[model samples]
Target chain A: MTKIAKTSPESVRTVACIGAGVIGGGWVAHFLGRGYQVVAWDPAPDAEQKLRSLVDSAWPALERLGLAEGASKDNLTVAPTLAEAVAGADFVQESAPERLDLKADLLAEIDAALPEGVVVGSSTSGYSMSEMQVKAADPSRLVVGHPFNPPYLVPLVEVVGGEKSEQWAVDWASEFYRLAGKSVITMDQELPGFIGNRIQEAAWREALHMVAEGEATVAQIDQAMTDGPGLRWAFHGPCTTFHLAGGEGGMAHMLDHFGPSLKAPWTRLEAPELTTELRDRMVEQTDEVVDGRSTAELIAQRDRRMIAIMRALEEVEREEAAERGEGQA
Target chain B: MTKIAKTSPESVRTVACIGAGVIGGGWVAHFLGRGYQVVAWDPAPDAEQKLRSLVDSAWPALERLGLAEGASKDNLTVAPTLAEAVAGADFVQESAPERLDLKADLLAEIDAALPEGVVVGSSTSGYSMSEMQVKAADPSRLVVGHPFNPPYLVPLVEVVGGEKSEQWAVDWASEFYRLAGKSVITMDQELPGFIGNRIQEAAWREALHMVAEGEATVAQIDQAMTDGPGLRWAFHGPCTTFHLAGGEGGMAHMLDHFGPSLKAPWTRLEAPELTTELRDRMVEQTDEVVDGRSTAELIAQRDRRMIAIMRALEEVEREEAAERGEGQA
Candidate 1:
């Protein structure tokens, strides 16, 4: 295993996970994999069993990536209440239902129980950090640490600060997430969907428009992205990929080549108000594409492929390092 | 290797590639890999050597994918001129410069040289197919068959038809590309960047705006995508991923959770017009993130990762097939 930077066993001894849903379960797996004892709370019956099952299924890929650390399943504990989950915890991750009222109420409860200086992070997809931290005792200690689903595999965690959020809190959260093997991006200010969701929404908006307009089927549009820009964007980002599209001259050439078309009214900025017909179409199309695959099977397949990609990247990095050494010699 | 649907070799025995640049060379490699004789033309003095080197480097990967079809290097021939390249060709793929006038002249030349019933496809990124085919001998035969870079690896090919293009021509072209191990998406009309580039451009526009607004650095923004949605998106499209984002309810739940945020003016529809300052910042930031990785190295890394991912998907498919068979028994 590559030595994780700036992390120590003592730095994050106990982590609290509030809400043991799909996202929360993923967080638990990630924290446990990184050698932290996880304390989780969820009012739902069978939450523990569900989370355990997810963690068990996720372990092999995590182990392959050196993500599983010095802990076993026995190290994870289920807290009967929120306070119990957070007591003596170094960090708390909240993945409650997305209602602001529910989140605010939970924050108040959690704030009263949290030890001073402990960082509280939210797994919010669209809620503002300012709103979520309104009821916190020390709002400065609360930060929005929005992670992509299946956090054990996906590396992104968008770290944002509320109006009262302290710089140290953001830095500490960022550092902690990095220690947990996540790629952290600190936002200047909290925005809807942070960065990833907004981009996703824009693309979705256009795709929905195409489908609505009868220009293409859901399958065709999906294939175009997966087989084309999605593949490129997976490795090189949209900006860099476009810069390459411009050929040797880079973005300048690209802009010159395709700039005029940017003004075209083809982009349906108006969000497709999801009519029942559209919704049914989407569900039907998705079913067709993913037929015969259960959610568990799809997730497992996704995890394995993610592991393979990460391993390939590691191999590339190793080769580059060797080449650099040879050049130096 | 999965059993590929056989395409009769007689239908596309000889492929004529005009302008043996990067894209054209990719076509040459793809066709030759699929057991088609490829005749190519380029004005550059060393075009033949360059194409040869590209094909040689690409061959091993093609062989691994069962795409090389046991063809020799000599299967790809460089003709002295456009006329010579198109002579006796079954299908002609024009990858000449993106300039409209250049394409106009080249298409006319190709149309005049190729025998009757030969399908002519353009590798134009966004030029209208109707406009490009305006001067062709039989404009109905012209179609846009744009493939993403490293075409042999990436499966997406956008097939758009000219105003005069026949349904049979489009279907034939689609089948031919699929036979060469590509996934085809048909476009109703030729719009700028077609489906993939336009969607990508939307994301890039926002990324640039964020950078210009000082919301995040280029590296941070790039990391956000690579570590976040980019990872999941490799397995599923944006819409599908977002549908999963809604948790159990799918797109409806996702929309309800995030739909309100669509009205927020977070993304700059007009990205500060990509000023010189922004351009320099973009280039510098991209360099930092890429850290001196050569284009060839990046391409190889991309190819390696893609192959690994496809193999993993294949495994999942096989397992599912086995399970279905067992259930039936």
Candidate 2:
């Protein structure tokens, strides 16, 4: 297999963020923090100010995590139009709303002005790359590089390619993300929610079922994840955690011990389809749980913790690297 | 309704850690860090040294999170016997090997020496409090307080009651954990894996099914959590995330939109019973995925990230508290 050359942020001097919403601002923060000049476009009248504020607020966290290596507000500029945003850009990230029509229209406009080698990606949560690339003039250049929210802090970015997306595009995008300090997972095929969302959806489905059946309360279900697998999943991921659950036998042992339980009809897997009643119950329950916590407060809390986690990880990585270096010496 | 006095750590002067294994060592670190004198008991000749090393390693991470307030080796004493360990203890935490008979036998010894008013809690992951207390002189004194691995870092501690466990025991244990800066979720009754473990089991069961069916690789399954819900879950619990998923419709909208998908045949809720073949596959896949990472290495990584997250949460809490204080002024 031929190794594809990765794009370093330094090498990609210019980038564009299309549809400067919450996620788009994250893209700007991430790109600008890594030292790439960003040209962002959003039709919203307050888009520029919103993006600026978001980027500015995220900077301290970015700097704390060493993500602000080459960042400065001067490196970011708001383009009046989408065509102008894609002009001279090596990378373009679309954070448009999740409507398929809106995405297709935006991508078509983007494709018309996109540089020959520019890799255009979307931050769409549920849309497949195949669907998004269908309307693109050069669909081969499109990739699905969906990132978790507050992207500058969360390391995960799912990299997927459409049928029209070239292998090189996937490889190149993966490398670009790696250089930008994001953990990249390249999907073999595009699936709804890709890998992360699917798993989350699965878990969420089961949790909702539990609530629908009155077997567990909303707080009980949430507590189960946070106090249990949530803690482990944040660091190790589900596969590894289950692997550990297997004990000395690994996943096999875990399966042998608890496999019988999985067949229990009690799973409530058929959770009464989320009726309006259930939805109201869930909202009321959640509001009661979060109480008056604002989005800003939540975001700040999230960023502070994420930085701390990243720093600790960096320390561990450094120590491991030093040990490896010592061993080699 | 008479207000129950909130359980606080102020009254907990001594904590006896029964069975000085990894989990027990974690208990010692948390108790001592929170200013309680920790008395540990184990039959191993090097129990003292092992406990000391674990405590020492835990201190830096704990200190980083502002959790290691009064931590000191001098505050930790290794007892020659279980009886000696609980002589003056205000709380007894048993982390003995997961053998029912062994636990039963040990509890009898521990119960004989526990000071009056002290809460006796087991760290058993799935065992019922009734089972552990079956051998106790006063079963009402026993409670199930299961902490996630490396209890010193992960804040969740599931406080469950058996048929015999008194309300006061649960309340006192909850308060003690809160004072130690742990998040406490009380289960009204005993269930296998309590709250966190059972939900995790549900997810894991499905994850195993996915792997067995070859729907995804170990890495893919793991990524699904880390990159997707895992990221959201690190900050907000599952219920809140779903509530957000509902968007404007909140949980009700989310249920309405995604509820139909719940009944899909693709839902892995009907997991195959853990046949021997499936178990082997799980083990083989996990080993292949994990490569050769040691438990300690994996745990250290987990601890490092957890500390970072907790520290971040603490900062947010501090900020919120400061804001509230200023508003009052």
Candidate 3:
């Protein structure tokens, strides 16, 4: 069972993004900003226009982050069909709707048309890659390259493989993602919701319980983070933060001190019954916070803020890297 | 019962910070930056020197964040004793050690020395204010003003009252904290960790379970957040983020779609057994990530990066305020 080694991501100049909705279109914009000639396709009739608009909306942020040489909107081409989109592509990302059947069919179709060793990554947030790879002829090269929202701005990409996936494919995808300016987490085992979503879901569940019990408002919960732990998380992970909390003793001391409180009723692990009352309260609270802006407006504000944060981190990161004399590439 | 109406926080010109550890020292620096005359005292022999050095290290970041018209290091006075620290102070912030007995005795001591109607706020991260207020002669004026690490940079200070604490005291403390440049959450009722610490503890417990079970490394777990959901958290909290995930339907659709997964085996609500094996693994992994940097070095890096993130958020916040003519005052 010999394996086909993958190409160096730096050597791959053209990329393909299939099913260009919000997630796919974000990938298209991100790739284009990195100077990759992007071939995009979606079955929807208005897909081309929507994708182009998203690219345009995202460009200013990319420019602020500093675009790669030769990067432009002109570099993105909308193909009429999937085969044409992946015909000569070096990498393909499938971001179809979350229907498991739809994703299985879409991934298999991309696999059939693509050349060997050209990895096909999925943008599905929660689906297991093994389930999506079942219908593919060459499932060995399929990998999950899950990203957070506004993929063009956020640098994280969770890279993992299916049961049928080859180790080399996962390795290649992780390396490619890093070269593409993403913070890559390569997971050794498959877990429901992966790593990031799982941690997020736990916190989300607890937050809902808080709202259901009428302990806090949606606004207060948001403030608790953006003004508190979230600031620490920007530079360090939760583990690191807690380790810092341990003072000089590190995680060991922290666990011994705060370990008993973990079992206290600080959190409700069970799902809170989201009754109609809770639902309306959530909607109304969010509406009050939104204060007459559309979802698009909220998203645009988020993007603008996200860009500022990334640039701030980059300012220090670039300096630290220069001092170390290590080329980022 | 009739309430004693609190005075306006803008009238506060002097602040007393007792027991000057990191959190206490941070309060001193933050108050000084807001242009208040700061009087601080600590029992440790080197406390004055350590406190002064901390304020000096943080001064540059606070300067970048912009200081009040009269803000200066020259305004700080390290008192010879706790009684002197609170003498003639317009407000008091107590940041003694986390021990309940020590805090109870200390709060009572401060209460006896404080003038009528002046509020005294504690900096305990997890203890209930009521527990700490038990021994105080004037418990009505005691409130919890829990803050995250490096309080000079992070703006959140969870303010809440104990069973004996007066409403006016909590209100006065909250408003005073806001005027002092802290984002204040005045909780209605006392819970174990207040809102921010409760939410953070839930995530921390789940993360520890992952590490204990050998499902993920300490570094990988941290990576999962800093790269993924942590990005969204900087702008929005968990509830708002899940609402965004629901597409146009908001939290209702999100609850309906992903609510069932809340009960899945994704989290270990009970504390994981922190046996020596688990403890050693955590320590070693953290050391590797620290990469020979002393804890002091790690903390310095965190402080520098934290200042960068806060400044980034402030840039947009200031802009949005100007557009709305709020003046950020």
Docking class of 3: acceptable
lDDT of 3 by residue, B1-329 (tens): 22453346788888999988878988888888889999999999999999998798668666766799999998999999888888778889999988899999999989887777788899997589989999988799899999987787777999999999998889999989998888899999887777887778777766655655556666777778876778567645676565555545545555556555555566654233333443333334333333465433432343344446656766877887887899873
Model 2 reaches what TM-score against the true structure? 0.67
Compare candidates 1 and 3 on DockQ and give the better one.
3
lDDT of candidate 2 at residue A211, scale 0 to 100 = 45
* Model 2 chain A poorest ten-residue lDDT run: A1-10
- Tell me how far the alpha carbon of residue A168 in candidate 1 is from the true structure, in angstroms, after superposition: 1.2
In model 2, which runs have C-alpha deviations exceeding 4 angstroms? A1-11, A41-88, A101-117, A135-137, A206-235, A238-329, B1-11, B32-88, B100-117, B131-137, B202-234, B240-329
lDDT of 3 by residue, A1-329 (tens): 22675467778888899989978998999999989899999999999999998898778667766798999999999998899999989999888988899999989899898977898889987688998899998999899999876687777788899999999889988988888888898989887777777788667666655655557666677789877887667645787666555555445555566555556666755323333443333334333433565533443344345446756766767766877797562
What local distance difference test score does each model get?
0.69, 0.68, 0.76
- Native-referenced TM-scores of chain A, all candidate models: 0.78, 0.77, 0.81
Residue-by-residue lDDT tens digits, candidate 1, A99-148: 99999889878878887778889998768889888877777778899987
What digit string (tens of lDDT, one per residue) describes model 2 on residues A39-137?
999999999998898787777666655555567878999999888888878888999987888898888789888867678888988678888788778
Candidate with better TM-score, 1 vs 3? 3
List the candidates ranked by DockQ, beginning with the highest.
Answer: 3, 2, 1
**TM-score, per-candidate, Cα-based:** 0.77, 0.67, 0.79
| Tens-digit per-residue lDDT, B35-150, candidate 1 | 88889999999999999987886776566555645566688888887888888788889899888888988888888877777778899875878878878777777889998876
